[model samples]
Target: MSQNDGTGQKPQPGKKAPSGKTLARRQARTLAMQALYSWHMAGQSLNEIEAQFRVDNDFAAVDGAYFHEILHGVPRQKTEIDGAFESLLDRPLEEIDPVELSILRLSTYELKNRIDIPYRVVINEGIELAKVFGATDGHKFVNGVLDKLAPRLRADEVRANKR
Candidate 1:
Protein backbone atom coordinates (compact mmCIF):
# COMPACT_ATOMS: atom_id res chain seq x y z
CA MET A 1 0.00 0.00 0.00
CA SER A 2 1.32 3.42 -0.90
CA GLN A 3 1.37 6.03 1.84
CA ASN A 4 0.19 9.58 1.35
CA ASP A 5 2.78 12.21 2.10
CA GLY A 6 1.78 15.37 3.95
CA THR A 7 1.25 17.12 0.64
CA GLY A 8 -1.56 14.63 -0.02
CA GLN A 9 0.05 12.73 -2.85
CA LYS A 10 1.63 9.30 -2.98
CA PRO A 11 5.26 9.62 -2.00
CA GLN A 12 7.40 9.75 -5.08
CA PRO A 13 10.36 7.49 -5.20
CA GLY A 14 13.66 9.32 -4.64
CA LYS A 15 11.88 12.59 -3.99
CA LYS A 16 12.20 14.36 -0.66
CA ALA A 17 9.27 16.09 0.95
CA PRO A 18 9.68 19.83 1.19
CA SER A 19 10.35 21.09 4.69
CA GLY A 20 8.37 23.71 6.55
CA LYS A 21 10.13 26.91 7.47
CA THR A 22 10.94 25.72 11.00
CA LEU A 23 12.29 22.39 9.84
CA ALA A 24 14.23 24.08 7.09
CA ARG A 25 15.78 26.40 9.63
CA ARG A 26 16.60 23.45 11.85
CA GLN A 27 18.28 21.74 8.94
CA ALA A 28 20.20 24.93 8.30
CA ARG A 29 21.44 25.00 11.89
CA THR A 30 22.41 21.34 11.76
CA LEU A 31 24.38 21.82 8.59
CA ALA A 32 25.97 24.97 9.92
CA MET A 33 27.09 23.10 13.02
CA GLN A 34 28.75 20.44 10.90
CA ALA A 35 30.41 23.01 8.69
CA LEU A 36 31.59 24.93 11.71
CA TYR A 37 32.98 21.77 13.24
CA SER A 38 34.91 21.07 10.05
CA TRP A 39 36.27 24.61 9.92
CA HIS A 40 37.32 24.37 13.55
CA MET A 41 39.05 21.04 13.16
CA ALA A 42 40.79 21.77 9.87
CA GLY A 43 41.55 25.51 10.18
CA GLN A 44 40.32 25.82 6.62
CA SER A 45 38.90 28.94 5.06
CA LEU A 46 35.21 29.47 5.87
CA ASN A 47 34.46 30.08 2.21
CA GLU A 48 36.03 26.79 1.25
CA ILE A 49 34.16 24.95 3.95
CA GLU A 50 30.89 26.59 2.95
CA ALA A 51 31.43 25.79 -0.70
CA GLN A 52 32.28 22.22 0.17
CA PHE A 53 29.18 21.87 2.30
CA ARG A 54 26.94 23.28 -0.40
CA VAL A 55 28.32 20.84 -2.92
CA ASP A 56 28.14 17.87 -0.56
CA ASN A 57 24.70 18.28 0.96
CA ASP A 58 21.11 18.04 -0.31
CA PHE A 59 19.70 21.52 0.23
CA ALA A 60 16.39 20.93 -1.48
CA ALA A 61 14.41 21.11 1.75
CA VAL A 62 16.80 23.29 3.69
CA ASP A 63 16.55 27.02 4.23
CA GLY A 64 19.35 28.02 1.89
CA ALA A 65 19.43 31.65 2.98
CA TYR A 66 19.45 30.80 6.67
CA PHE A 67 22.10 28.16 6.09
CA HIS A 68 24.21 30.70 4.26
CA GLU A 69 23.64 33.22 7.02
CA ILE A 70 24.81 30.91 9.79
CA LEU A 71 27.66 29.31 7.84
CA HIS A 72 29.08 32.78 7.36
CA GLY A 73 27.66 34.70 10.27
CA VAL A 74 29.16 32.66 13.09
CA PRO A 75 32.70 32.88 11.80
CA ARG A 76 32.31 36.49 10.76
CA GLN A 77 31.40 37.35 14.32
CA LYS A 78 33.45 34.69 16.08
CA THR A 79 35.26 36.92 18.51
CA GLU A 80 32.13 38.69 19.73
CA ILE A 81 30.04 35.56 19.77
CA ASP A 82 32.67 33.68 21.75
CA GLY A 83 33.26 36.56 24.10
CA ALA A 84 29.55 36.71 24.87
CA PHE A 85 29.59 33.24 26.33
CA GLU A 86 33.19 32.28 27.01
CA SER A 87 33.22 33.74 30.49
CA LEU A 88 30.14 31.71 31.34
CA LEU A 89 31.93 28.47 30.59
CA ASP A 90 33.25 26.45 33.49
CA ARG A 91 36.23 25.30 31.43
CA PRO A 92 38.56 26.81 28.93
CA LEU A 93 37.26 27.11 25.37
CA GLU A 94 39.77 24.51 24.25
CA GLU A 95 38.19 22.04 26.65
CA ILE A 96 34.82 22.21 24.91
CA ASP A 97 33.75 19.38 22.63
CA PRO A 98 33.96 20.60 19.06
CA VAL A 99 30.30 19.82 18.36
CA GLU A 100 29.14 21.60 21.49
CA LEU A 101 31.38 24.54 20.75
CA SER A 102 29.97 24.82 17.26
CA ILE A 103 26.41 24.72 18.55
CA LEU A 104 27.16 27.31 21.20
CA ARG A 105 28.71 29.71 18.75
CA LEU A 106 25.87 29.37 16.25
CA SER A 107 23.12 29.87 18.83
CA THR A 108 24.95 32.75 20.46
CA TYR A 109 25.15 34.48 17.12
CA GLU A 110 21.39 34.22 16.69
CA LEU A 111 20.79 35.49 20.18
CA LYS A 112 22.95 38.55 19.68
CA ASN A 113 22.09 39.40 16.09
CA ARG A 114 18.69 37.92 15.31
CA ILE A 115 16.47 39.84 17.62
CA ASP A 116 13.41 38.59 15.72
CA ILE A 117 14.03 35.17 17.24
CA PRO A 118 13.09 35.00 20.87
CA TYR A 119 15.84 34.38 23.43
CA ARG A 120 14.03 31.26 24.65
CA VAL A 121 14.05 29.90 21.11
CA VAL A 122 17.74 30.59 20.77
CA ILE A 123 18.39 28.69 23.99
CA ASN A 124 16.04 25.86 23.04
CA GLU A 125 17.62 25.47 19.63
CA GLY A 126 21.04 25.31 21.26
CA ILE A 127 19.83 22.65 23.67
CA GLU A 128 18.25 20.68 20.84
CA LEU A 129 21.40 20.85 18.76
CA ALA A 130 23.46 19.72 21.70
CA LYS A 131 21.11 16.80 22.30
CA VAL A 132 21.44 15.74 18.67
CA PHE A 133 25.14 16.35 18.07
CA GLY A 134 26.87 16.61 21.40
CA ALA A 135 27.99 14.11 24.03
CA THR A 136 25.59 12.77 26.61
CA ASP A 137 24.64 15.50 29.12
CA GLY A 138 25.97 18.14 26.76
CA HIS A 139 22.46 19.48 26.37
CA LYS A 140 22.51 20.61 29.99
CA PHE A 141 25.73 22.48 29.46
CA VAL A 142 24.29 24.14 26.37
CA ASN A 143 21.16 25.04 28.24
CA GLY A 144 23.09 26.58 31.10
CA VAL A 145 25.39 28.61 28.91
CA LEU A 146 22.65 29.89 26.60
CA ASP A 147 20.42 30.66 29.58
CA LYS A 148 23.13 32.89 30.99
CA LEU A 149 23.96 34.48 27.68
CA ALA A 150 20.35 35.24 26.76
CA PRO A 151 19.76 37.96 29.27
CA ARG A 152 22.94 39.69 28.29
CA LEU A 153 22.18 39.51 24.59
CA ARG A 154 18.42 40.03 24.70
CA ALA A 155 17.93 42.04 27.80
CA ASP A 156 14.58 43.59 26.90
CA GLU A 157 13.08 40.43 25.44
CA VAL A 158 14.25 38.27 28.29
CA ARG A 159 13.06 40.84 30.78
CA ALA A 160 9.65 41.03 29.15
CA ASN A 161 9.29 37.27 29.11
CA LYS A 162 10.05 37.02 32.83
CA ARG A 163 7.46 39.56 33.79
Candidate 2:
Protein backbone atom coordinates (compact mmCIF):
# COMPACT_ATOMS: atom_id res chain seq x y z
CA MET A 1 0.00 0.00 0.00
CA SER A 2 1.17 3.53 -0.78
CA GLN A 3 1.89 5.86 2.11
CA ASN A 4 1.19 9.61 2.14
CA ASP A 5 3.05 12.68 3.30
CA GLY A 6 1.71 15.60 5.30
CA THR A 7 0.67 17.53 2.21
CA GLY A 8 -1.15 14.46 0.89
CA GLN A 9 1.70 13.64 -1.40
CA LYS A 10 2.24 9.94 -1.90
CA PRO A 11 5.85 9.13 -1.11
CA GLN A 12 8.37 6.90 -2.80
CA PRO A 13 10.29 4.24 -0.88
CA GLY A 14 12.44 5.46 2.06
CA LYS A 15 11.06 8.98 2.03
CA LYS A 16 11.24 11.29 5.05
CA ALA A 17 8.64 11.23 7.77
CA PRO A 18 5.32 13.04 7.46
CA SER A 19 5.11 16.27 9.41
CA GLY A 20 3.86 16.27 12.98
CA LYS A 21 0.95 18.50 12.01
CA THR A 22 -0.18 16.04 9.35
CA LEU A 23 -0.32 13.16 11.76
CA ALA A 24 -2.04 15.46 14.24
CA ARG A 25 -4.60 16.41 11.63
CA ARG A 26 -5.40 12.77 10.97
CA GLN A 27 -5.85 12.14 14.67
CA ALA A 28 -7.93 15.27 14.99
CA ARG A 29 -10.14 14.11 12.17
CA THR A 30 -10.71 10.79 13.90
CA LEU A 31 -11.55 12.50 17.16
CA ALA A 32 -13.89 14.85 15.33
CA MET A 33 -15.70 11.93 13.77
CA GLN A 34 -16.15 10.28 17.13
CA ALA A 35 -17.35 13.57 18.57
CA LEU A 36 -19.77 14.14 15.70
CA TYR A 37 -21.13 10.62 16.02
CA SER A 38 -21.59 11.14 19.73
CA TRP A 39 -23.46 14.37 19.14
CA HIS A 40 -25.65 12.75 16.52
CA MET A 41 -26.58 9.95 18.89
CA ALA A 42 -27.14 12.21 21.91
CA GLY A 43 -28.81 15.04 19.99
CA GLN A 44 -26.56 17.57 21.68
CA SER A 45 -25.21 20.89 20.47
CA LEU A 46 -21.69 20.74 18.99
CA ASN A 47 -20.25 23.19 21.45
CA GLU A 48 -21.76 21.51 24.48
CA ILE A 49 -20.80 18.09 23.28
CA GLU A 50 -17.25 18.99 22.25
CA ALA A 51 -16.61 20.97 25.37
CA GLN A 52 -17.76 18.09 27.53
CA PHE A 53 -15.68 15.66 25.57
CA ARG A 54 -12.66 17.88 25.97
CA VAL A 55 -13.16 18.12 29.70
CA ASP A 56 -13.76 14.44 30.07
CA ASN A 57 -11.17 13.09 27.71
CA ASP A 58 -8.56 15.87 27.48
CA PHE A 59 -8.94 15.89 23.71
CA ALA A 60 -6.95 19.13 23.72
CA ALA A 61 -3.97 16.99 22.88
CA VAL A 62 -5.15 17.10 19.27
CA ASP A 63 -5.29 20.07 16.92
CA GLY A 64 -8.43 22.07 17.65
CA ALA A 65 -8.60 23.68 14.20
CA TYR A 66 -8.59 20.36 12.41
CA PHE A 67 -11.27 19.05 14.72
CA HIS A 68 -13.47 22.14 14.37
CA GLU A 69 -13.17 22.43 10.60
CA ILE A 70 -14.02 18.78 9.88
CA LEU A 71 -16.83 18.48 12.41
CA HIS A 72 -18.47 21.75 11.41
CA GLY A 73 -17.72 21.51 7.70
CA VAL A 74 -19.15 18.01 7.35
CA PRO A 75 -22.48 18.92 8.92
CA ARG A 76 -22.57 22.25 7.16
CA GLN A 77 -22.34 20.48 3.84
CA LYS A 78 -24.37 17.45 4.90
CA THR A 79 -27.26 18.00 2.52
CA GLU A 80 -25.00 18.18 -0.50
CA ILE A 81 -22.88 15.31 0.78
CA ASP A 82 -25.92 13.13 1.33
CA GLY A 83 -27.16 14.09 -2.10
CA ALA A 84 -23.91 12.81 -3.61
CA PHE A 85 -24.14 9.65 -1.53
CA GLU A 86 -27.78 9.12 -2.47
CA SER A 87 -26.84 9.28 -6.13
CA LEU A 88 -24.05 6.74 -5.63
CA LEU A 89 -25.31 4.36 -2.93
CA ASP A 90 -27.84 1.58 -3.48
CA ARG A 91 -29.81 2.90 -0.48
CA PRO A 92 -30.50 6.24 1.15
CA LEU A 93 -28.02 7.71 3.59
CA GLU A 94 -30.63 7.37 6.31
CA GLU A 95 -30.42 3.62 5.97
CA ILE A 96 -26.70 3.64 6.84
CA ASP A 97 -25.61 3.11 10.42
CA PRO A 98 -24.57 6.27 12.29
CA VAL A 99 -20.93 5.18 12.55
CA GLU A 100 -20.77 4.36 8.87
CA LEU A 101 -22.55 7.61 8.15
CA SER A 102 -19.86 9.53 10.02
CA ILE A 103 -17.14 7.82 8.03
CA LEU A 104 -18.90 8.66 4.78
CA ARG A 105 -19.41 12.26 5.77
CA LEU A 106 -15.75 12.76 6.64
CA SER A 107 -14.48 11.09 3.50
CA THR A 108 -16.91 12.96 1.29
CA TYR A 109 -15.89 16.26 2.81
CA GLU A 110 -12.21 15.55 2.19
CA LEU A 111 -12.87 14.33 -1.34
CA LYS A 112 -14.81 17.49 -2.11
CA ASN A 113 -12.83 20.15 -0.29
CA ARG A 114 -9.34 18.83 0.26
CA ILE A 115 -8.15 18.23 -3.25
CA ASP A 116 -4.62 17.89 -1.92
CA ILE A 117 -5.62 14.56 -0.43
CA PRO A 118 -5.68 11.75 -2.94
CA TYR A 119 -9.05 10.13 -3.60
CA ARG A 120 -7.67 6.72 -2.77
CA VAL A 121 -6.34 7.95 0.57
CA VAL A 122 -9.69 9.49 1.42
CA ILE A 123 -11.47 6.25 0.63
CA ASN A 124 -8.86 4.20 2.49
CA GLU A 125 -9.20 6.36 5.57
CA GLY A 126 -12.97 5.97 5.46
CA ILE A 127 -12.60 2.23 5.13
CA GLU A 128 -10.31 2.20 8.14
CA LEU A 129 -12.84 4.20 10.11
CA ALA A 130 -15.54 1.72 9.17
CA LYS A 131 -13.34 -1.21 10.14
CA VAL A 132 -12.76 0.27 13.58
CA PHE A 133 -16.22 1.64 14.28
CA GLY A 134 -18.77 0.03 12.01
CA ALA A 135 -20.45 -3.34 11.40
CA THR A 136 -18.64 -6.34 9.95
CA ASP A 137 -19.35 -5.44 6.32
CA GLY A 138 -19.42 -1.70 6.75
CA HIS A 139 -15.93 -1.09 5.33
CA LYS A 140 -16.93 -2.74 2.08
CA PHE A 141 -20.07 -0.66 1.91
CA VAL A 142 -18.17 2.58 2.57
CA ASN A 143 -15.50 1.66 0.05
CA GLY A 144 -18.02 0.83 -2.64
CA VAL A 145 -20.02 4.01 -2.24
CA LEU A 146 -16.98 6.28 -1.98
CA ASP A 147 -15.29 4.61 -4.92
CA LYS A 148 -18.29 5.38 -7.10
CA LEU A 149 -18.64 8.91 -5.82
CA ALA A 150 -14.92 9.83 -6.03
CA PRO A 151 -14.63 9.61 -9.81
CA ARG A 152 -17.79 11.61 -10.30
CA LEU A 153 -16.93 14.31 -7.82
CA ARG A 154 -13.34 14.49 -9.04
CA ALA A 155 -13.93 13.76 -12.69
CA ASP A 156 -12.04 16.72 -14.08
CA GLU A 157 -9.03 16.20 -11.86
CA VAL A 158 -8.99 12.47 -12.48
CA ARG A 159 -9.26 12.91 -16.22
CA ALA A 160 -6.50 15.50 -16.22
CA ASN A 161 -4.14 13.45 -14.07
CA LYS A 162 -5.01 10.07 -15.52
CA ARG A 163 -5.85 8.46 -12.19
Candidate 3:
Protein backbone atom coordinates (compact mmCIF):
# COMPACT_ATOMS: atom_id res chain seq x y z
CA MET A 1 0.00 0.00 0.00
CA SER A 2 1.14 3.50 -0.66
CA GLN A 3 2.03 5.51 2.40
CA ASN A 4 0.84 8.99 3.12
CA ASP A 5 3.28 11.67 4.15
CA GLY A 6 2.54 13.28 7.51
CA THR A 7 0.63 16.03 5.79
CA GLY A 8 -1.79 13.51 4.19
CA GLN A 9 -0.09 13.83 0.84
CA LYS A 10 0.81 10.49 -0.71
CA PRO A 11 4.37 9.94 -1.85
CA GLN A 12 4.26 9.61 -5.61
CA PRO A 13 7.65 8.48 -6.78
CA GLY A 14 7.99 10.92 -9.65
CA LYS A 15 5.89 13.82 -8.42
CA LYS A 16 7.83 16.88 -7.54
CA ALA A 17 7.17 18.66 -4.25
CA PRO A 18 4.87 21.60 -4.79
CA SER A 19 6.65 24.92 -4.78
CA GLY A 20 6.01 27.38 -1.97
CA LYS A 21 3.95 29.65 -4.21
CA THR A 22 1.84 26.71 -5.38
CA LEU A 23 1.17 25.53 -1.85
CA ALA A 24 0.14 29.02 -0.84
CA ARG A 25 -2.23 29.22 -3.78
CA ARG A 26 -3.71 25.86 -2.88
CA GLN A 27 -4.37 27.06 0.63
CA ALA A 28 -5.86 30.23 -0.75
CA ARG A 29 -8.25 28.15 -2.85
CA THR A 30 -9.16 26.10 0.17
CA LEU A 31 -9.95 29.21 2.16
CA ALA A 32 -11.86 30.71 -0.72
CA MET A 33 -14.05 27.63 -0.98
CA GLN A 34 -14.95 27.82 2.67
CA ALA A 35 -15.78 31.48 2.38
CA LEU A 36 -17.96 30.90 -0.64
CA TYR A 37 -19.77 27.99 0.94
CA SER A 38 -20.70 30.24 3.81
CA TRP A 39 -21.95 32.85 1.42
CA HIS A 40 -23.97 30.39 -0.63
CA MET A 41 -25.53 28.55 2.28
CA ALA A 42 -26.06 31.35 4.76
CA GLY A 43 -26.60 34.19 2.32
CA GLN A 44 -23.95 36.26 3.96
CA SER A 45 -22.67 39.42 2.38
CA LEU A 46 -19.31 39.18 0.65
CA ASN A 47 -17.64 41.67 2.93
CA GLU A 48 -18.94 39.87 5.99
CA ILE A 49 -17.74 36.50 4.76
CA GLU A 50 -14.31 37.86 3.96
CA ALA A 51 -13.98 39.57 7.28
CA GLN A 52 -14.97 36.36 9.03
CA PHE A 53 -12.32 34.38 7.14
CA ARG A 54 -9.64 36.85 8.12
CA VAL A 55 -10.56 36.52 11.78
CA ASP A 56 -11.37 32.80 11.92
CA ASN A 57 -8.62 31.29 9.76
CA ASP A 58 -4.88 31.47 9.99
CA PHE A 59 -3.87 33.51 6.96
CA ALA A 60 -0.25 34.33 7.62
CA ALA A 61 0.96 31.41 5.52
CA VAL A 62 -1.55 31.46 2.67
CA ASP A 63 -1.87 33.85 -0.25
CA GLY A 64 -4.07 36.31 1.61
CA ALA A 65 -4.36 38.56 -1.43
CA TYR A 66 -5.44 35.69 -3.65
CA PHE A 67 -7.95 34.57 -1.06
CA HIS A 68 -9.30 38.09 -0.91
CA GLU A 69 -9.71 38.23 -4.66
CA ILE A 70 -11.52 34.88 -4.94
CA LEU A 71 -13.80 35.43 -1.97
CA HIS A 72 -14.86 38.81 -3.33
CA GLY A 73 -14.64 38.15 -7.05
CA VAL A 74 -16.84 35.06 -7.12
CA PRO A 75 -19.75 36.79 -5.44
CA ARG A 76 -19.17 39.99 -7.37
CA GLN A 77 -19.56 37.88 -10.49
CA LYS A 78 -21.95 35.30 -9.08
CA THR A 79 -24.66 35.88 -11.64
CA GLU A 80 -22.27 35.39 -14.54
CA ILE A 81 -20.43 32.51 -12.91
CA ASP A 82 -23.59 30.66 -11.99
CA GLY A 83 -25.07 31.36 -15.38
CA ALA A 84 -22.09 29.72 -17.03
CA PHE A 85 -22.44 26.64 -14.85
CA GLU A 86 -26.20 26.72 -15.32
CA SER A 87 -25.80 26.19 -19.05
CA LEU A 88 -23.33 23.33 -18.51
CA LEU A 89 -25.32 21.75 -15.69
CA ASP A 90 -28.48 19.72 -16.03
CA ARG A 91 -30.16 21.53 -13.15
CA PRO A 92 -30.24 24.99 -11.69
CA LEU A 93 -27.30 26.11 -9.62
CA GLU A 94 -29.57 26.31 -6.57
CA GLU A 95 -29.80 22.53 -6.71
CA ILE A 96 -26.05 22.10 -6.41
CA ASP A 97 -24.39 21.33 -3.11
CA PRO A 98 -23.12 24.51 -1.50
CA VAL A 99 -19.61 23.13 -1.31
CA GLU A 100 -19.58 21.90 -4.88
CA LEU A 101 -21.21 25.10 -6.10
CA SER A 102 -18.59 27.13 -4.32
CA ILE A 103 -15.79 25.18 -5.94
CA LEU A 104 -17.43 25.44 -9.33
CA ARG A 105 -17.84 29.18 -9.01
CA LEU A 106 -14.16 29.53 -8.16
CA SER A 107 -13.17 27.43 -11.16
CA THR A 108 -15.55 29.36 -13.36
CA TYR A 109 -14.07 32.62 -12.13
CA GLU A 110 -10.55 31.43 -12.90
CA LEU A 111 -11.52 30.12 -16.32
CA LYS A 112 -13.26 33.30 -17.39
CA ASN A 113 -11.27 36.02 -15.65
CA ARG A 114 -7.84 34.53 -15.10
CA ILE A 115 -6.74 33.23 -18.47
CA ASP A 116 -3.14 33.55 -17.39
CA ILE A 117 -3.62 30.34 -15.45
CA PRO A 118 -3.95 27.21 -17.56
CA TYR A 119 -7.37 25.55 -17.83
CA ARG A 120 -5.94 22.22 -16.68
CA VAL A 121 -4.60 23.84 -13.55
CA VAL A 122 -8.02 25.32 -12.71
CA ILE A 123 -9.76 21.95 -13.20
CA ASN A 124 -7.22 20.10 -11.10
CA GLU A 125 -7.60 22.59 -8.30
CA GLY A 126 -11.39 22.38 -8.43
CA ILE A 127 -11.28 18.58 -8.33
CA GLU A 128 -8.97 18.66 -5.35
CA LEU A 129 -11.24 21.07 -3.51
CA ALA A 130 -14.31 18.98 -4.18
CA LYS A 131 -12.58 15.80 -3.10
CA VAL A 132 -11.57 17.30 0.18
CA PHE A 133 -14.63 19.35 1.06
CA GLY A 134 -17.59 18.28 -1.07
CA ALA A 135 -19.78 15.14 -0.98
CA THR A 136 -18.16 11.70 -1.30
CA ASP A 137 -18.61 11.44 -5.08
CA GLY A 138 -18.39 15.16 -5.67
CA HIS A 139 -14.97 15.08 -7.25
CA LYS A 140 -16.29 13.09 -10.20
CA PHE A 141 -19.04 15.62 -10.74
CA VAL A 142 -16.53 18.43 -10.49
CA ASN A 143 -14.29 16.66 -12.96
CA GLY A 144 -17.11 16.18 -15.44
CA VAL A 145 -18.38 19.75 -15.30
CA LEU A 146 -14.95 21.30 -15.48
CA ASP A 147 -13.87 18.95 -18.25
CA LYS A 148 -16.77 20.23 -20.32
CA LEU A 149 -15.97 23.81 -19.43
CA ALA A 150 -12.24 23.73 -20.26
CA PRO A 151 -12.55 23.46 -24.01
CA ARG A 152 -15.14 26.19 -24.19
CA LEU A 153 -13.12 28.53 -22.04
CA ARG A 154 -9.65 27.71 -23.27
CA ALA A 155 -10.03 26.23 -26.71
CA ASP A 156 -6.56 27.07 -27.94
CA GLU A 157 -4.86 25.73 -24.84
CA VAL A 158 -6.97 22.58 -24.83
CA ARG A 159 -6.22 21.92 -28.48
CA ALA A 160 -2.53 22.56 -27.90
CA ASN A 161 -2.42 20.23 -24.93
CA LYS A 162 -4.15 17.50 -26.90
CA ARG A 163 -1.23 17.23 -29.31
Leading candidate by TM-score: 3
Tell how far residue 48 is off in model 2, in angstroms.
1.0
Instruction: Note the Cα lDDT for every prediction shown.
Output: 0.87, 0.81, 0.88
Clashing pairs in 1: none
Local accuracy of candidate 3 as per-residue lDDT tens digits, 8-109: 687578886677787788889999999888888899888888888889988877889999899989988989887776788867777888899889999999
Better of 1 and 2 by TM-score: 1
- RMSD, every candidate, angstroms: 6.0, 4.5, 2.2
Off by over 4 Å in 1: 1-19
**Residue pairs that clash (backbone atoms under 3 angstroms), model 3:** none
Residue by residue across 1-101, what tens digits does model 1's lDDT show? 77654334464689665447766787888899999999899999988988898899988978889988998899899999999999999999999999999
| Candidates ranked by TM-score | 3, 1, 2
By lDDT, the candidates rank as 3, 1, 2
Which model scores highest in lDDT? 3
Tens-digit lDDT string for candidate 2 (15-128): 675567656776777788898798778888888867876776655447778788887888789889878778777776678799988888889899999998888778888897
* lDDT for position 66 in model 1: 93
